[model samples]
Target: MFWWFERSGEHLRLEVLQLAADKYELRVIDADGTARVETFANADDLAKRQTQLQHALSSQGWTGPHGWVM
Candidate 1:
């Protein structure tokens, strides 16, 4: 899955790819091209982590659109 959002006048992109039956890769990239990556054991785990990040961003005043902005 892939997602994108705009916050604080900046664009951010997230890419989630399945690497194996039980492994996945997540890549977060900023508009400036700086990127961070992480691996997860399963989709459920990834979803949990993503939710945590969303909460953190929201707490920091990062607002998302009603649907996907990308």
Candidate 2:
């Protein structure tokens, strides 16, 4: 799933995808559209990081859909 946000004239994108068995990837696009990728060993860790990012963005006045918990 993917969530999009905008704050201070910049765009943010968060995406989650399953790469393989028990493996997942988190893709984040920063304000300048710089992409960062992280791999998670489990769903729980991914969920935690996703929540953290959501909170951080919300605090910064970002407006978008909340992340989907897998």
Candidate topping lDDT: 2
Runs with alpha carbons beyond 4 Å of true place in candidate 2: 66-70
lDDT values of the candidates? 0.75, 0.87
Instruction: Tell me which residue pairs clash in candidate 2.
Output: none
Q: Ten-residue segment with the worst summed lDDT in candidate 2?
A: 61-70
Q: How would you encode candidate 2's per-residue C-alpha lDDT over 17-60 as one tens digit per residue?
A: 99987999999988787999999999999999989988998998
How well is each residue in 1-70 modelled by candidate 1, as lDDT tens digits?
A: 6676677788777777888999998787766999999899999999888787667766867675223432
What lDDT score goes with residue 52 in model 1?
78
Model 1 weakest lDDT span, ten residues long: 61-70
TM-score per candidate, chains pooled = 0.77, 0.83
